[model samples]
Target: MPPVPAAVDPDTLTSLLDGRWAGLRADIRAEMAAAPYRDPIDLSVEEHRSRVFDQLTALAANDRAGLGFDKAYGGGSDIGGSVVSFEMLGFGDLSLMVKAGVQWGLFGGAVQLLGTAPHHERYLRRIRDLDLLGCFAMTEHGHGSDVQHLRTTATYDPDSGEFVVHTPDRGATKEYIGNAARDGRVAVVFAQLTTQGETRGVHAFVVPIRDDAGAPAPGVTIEDCGPKAGLNGVDNGRLSFDQVRIPREALLNRFGDVAPDGTYSSPIEGDARRFFTMLGTLIRGRVSVGGSAGSATKRALALAVRYAELRRQFATPDGEEVVILDYLGHQRKLLPALATSYALHFAQEELVAALHDITDDAPEQEQRELESRAAGLKVANTWHATAAIQAAREACGGAGYLAENLLPGLKADTDVFTTFEGDNTVLLQLVAKGLLTEYKDAFQNLSPLATVRFAAERVLGAVAERTSARKVVDRLTDGDDREALFDRDWQLKLFEDREQHVLGGVADRLRKAAQDPFGVFNAAQDHVLRAGRVHVDRLVLEAFVRAIARCTDPDAKALLERVCDLYALANIEADRAWFLEHGRLSTGRSKAVIAAVNTLCGELRPHARTLVDAFAIPEQYLAAPMLS
Candidate 1:
């Protein structure tokens, strides 16, 4: 690794970090600066919701909110730019960020992706212009993670050529639905469709929840969720349908449709396959959530890093106070997390680009792979935000706890991210399921011992095939323990090997599921999660490596190389016990990994400000009285 320069140009780092969406980011930053955006510090829940709604309308009026929609609907048709715009909004009020996501990304996105041509023609422009605010009513009170078996029913009433949308019981009521409490006039509701006496699985329908006067429509019960821990600006509400009837044409029938005669037809055969396919089309929402979480983490780190550089503590023998960041403990708290934020940023950029470029006709395996990647990155980014933001709060001491300091809002608003888009634990298990089955029948066969055995048999061979060019086996045999700790290839090999080994171990344990499936799966759950986490860690490291290769400036490139090293080594150090037990790293090498992390933290400490500044968050958002 090259020695750190006296200083690296932050503009260069910013340019490299911006990647393909530099213009959109700059435009959004300028617009946010111009808007009356502020954290809802002391505002009432109603007041906060009003303010966030106004902000959402402002975003819609500028067309910034519709970048992901089709151009025919007065949109920019820039999917990646749309996601980047949402991420940039994370630097400001999180409530507004989420409001925009619900309006444009979720509500509008469902109408665009799941609905057919006539549905789009009628609703797309209105949705884009905020003439029609809507909710994504998918999560029922009974089923948050398991959407496949929702109790809500939309039975076809062929006599009147209408479908009766009904919540069978309290469990079927949609809970925590954004836009349902106050602003939403309509909702894209998910319910099991039944026609001709046969249930055709879950499908989305366009259900109007409110009348033109903004009152709840007949048979639609809307209940405000009330205030709680955070995000008071969002008007989350519960929705229940008491035999609400809508025209047959209200169904978003691109994947599955029913005729006036009550006959159901779909291009896809099985209900499970068709349902998964529909959900797959909405991957942009998951990607946006992860990217927004990254931006929030960056903001927290920036605030904490700047505070560390300014706040002076105990004096030395020379009677001069030292900056908190000058201490190794402070660096340990912030620097490695800072490095991880950078890595996740690059991985997120790659994901947004993939979402932008993927075609509707892309192969099923390719689509599934993209979904798995989105799920994994979401897990990584959100969990990192939760931990790193808490760390930032602690690093700022009592000041961070105050709502005035901004860290409190950041911490509270982002706390639900880990569970909302998808629960982090459940999502990790999904990733492991995908890997074990190679995306084959992943949703259908959740307990496939055959697939687990197949994956275990070929997992090591696949790892070797990927790292063969780096000659990881030969280098690990010949390289010195101290020197090889800094080798990027060695680090990559370690991550890959760990994932392969953990996955194999999980398979071995699950093989006994032939007798007691529940007991075996319960016992091996930890190994399953580790397999998912290590796989994502390896991908994030690779993304950082690829991003470093794209830097044109020598100093910035060198600086990024060291940042990448810190990220990789810090991960290895965190999981050193696994490596030590598996005989992948010697006792001396494990200790060397820790030493390398300490050394890297010291070396990178000088550039911490530069690292956080590259995120280029607006000054207005980072304005805390403590910093002054």
Candidate 2:
């Protein structure tokens, strides 16, 4: 958006892109450089499982698996760095990312965060070193997004000092659990806690799924989930515990505990709140999935951009064929996506940093904010990854259809990212709920007169700042000067106004419909989701802007501003109807937004390869033929 006083610097940008990442990336890159990690073939599910498992084993043997755990448990205690390195696996294979996510991020994380000292002392180091393999069994056959409704039960026996874990019915079976099918011998299973003939609530317990020799433990029935649409290398399985008993101490009691006398106690008194808080402690999986999906999108763009440069198509009048990339249509298809990838990279990095800080020592309120932010970004980034990867697949033409190209694999694998890391729809609702809760709280602590005044002020502010305000921005800038329209303040105002309008409007309608909370909320789900999307869109642009401001390299700074502007305008263009109907943009300005996007695409086209090269995916890991 700002004036560029210097040329683009790809080297500086790439180096800066890799800055601050811990050495785990170097180790991952080195491992990927090896033949086993670089295979591009389409192996069968069985073969694929073995490959991913062995890869996890190798990462563990080299002391690379526990970078995020507490230092007391042999981890580096670098939560953000661990996630940063984990996402790099996207450069290699989706299966590896999912497998490692299951092994470390989910299963081990449950023990480390939910379980108290004894559980950590006994299991953390072993999990870190791959001395033990475990599954995170939370989702059930009947309830995927609603974990509180999961039917698995852990009934306490005071006399015996043991808990009998059971799947009361087929619906209680844990579904799509990574590591359960073939590799896992232990599981951190989420089940309703029952004592003194009364159900307490859903709690996590360390239960043995299989014996040392890999056979199902007594009363534990495990079934393979079978081949999937993609990422078949992950041996997802279903588990049902038929009255399997374990020591009472097997309960992960960091958040809740039961006494030998059959009394239930928890740090959090409320059942529903306690369930969510316990689960929130294990939210790292969502963060890592989002980052990993972002990496996949970057790799896809790199592969496609490189291919477009090399694979020439229709010839000119002079009989020499032109590179497909030179065509406006092709650039339109890929360049906007490249811009989005850059925006997400910055947003995800910011999220990692924030998560690291908040998870380390922040208070409960900040942790709640972290949960909403993580949920929103994870949904937004994964959705972007799916769209970007699909566009990339089409951009590569028939070559993308080949499994070895990895775009298809990336699509299939990352598609589930939208659903698995808390289904995107549910996650957005969580974000919306957080926003609404905050709005409610703001008005709660004031006097009636103050509340009414606050309410009226907010109302008047929204009305003034709504779509009508776009005309003000337009009048301030020279409509013909694309640079003027792309101003950072202009972009921020536009995005922020859009979010405010959507959120404020939704808040009003929901307040009016508050009589039936669940029904009314369900009726307004679409608007609530829109509110969530706009908020995340605004955050992404803000991060991109902030990152550019921090850049010392002038050329890189200027070039990155264009990337940021492209991201902003492209989003505005995507939802132009809303902006136009709401009066946020005049017809001419809306078209200008599209025009600006094309202009940035053409300007950035020359640096496409270098931009993707900045992602620094090793050639071995990105084994697509086009890259070669």
Clashing pairs in 1: none
RMSD of each: 3.0, 2.4
Error of 1 at 310 (Å): 0.6
Which TM-score value belongs to model 2? 0.95
Tens-digit lDDT string for candidate 2 (1-628): 4555445656678766765673556666766776555553658889999988888887787555898889999998888887887788877778888888888999998998898889989999999998999999999999999988889999998989999999998899899999999999999999999999988789999999988788999999999999988888899999998889999999999888999998988878899888888877877899999989888898889889989998899899999999999998999889889988888888888888887877445787888888998999999889999888999999999998887777887788788889997999999988887878747854344567756775797778776785457565555345455765667787788788888888887776676453577887888999999999999999989988888877898778778877787788889889999988887677877788888888888887887777787777877666777556
lDDT of 1 by residue, 1-628 (tens): 6789889989899998999988888887787777665678989999999989888877777877789988988888899998998888888888888888998999999999999889989999999998999999999999999989999999999999999999999999999999899899999999999999999999999999999999999999999999968888888999999999999999999999999999999999999999999988987888989999999999999999999999999999999999999999999999999999999999999989999999989998888989999999999999999999999999999999999999999999999999998888999998898887843443245467856755655666656544552354346456675568888878887787788777766766675676787898888898899989999998999999999999989999999999999999999889978877766766776788888899999999999999998888888888898899
**TM-scores of all predicted structures:** 0.95, 0.95
Candidate 2 achieves a global lDDT of 0.84
Distance (Å) between predicted and true CA of 169, model 1? Answer: 0.8
Best by lDDT: 1
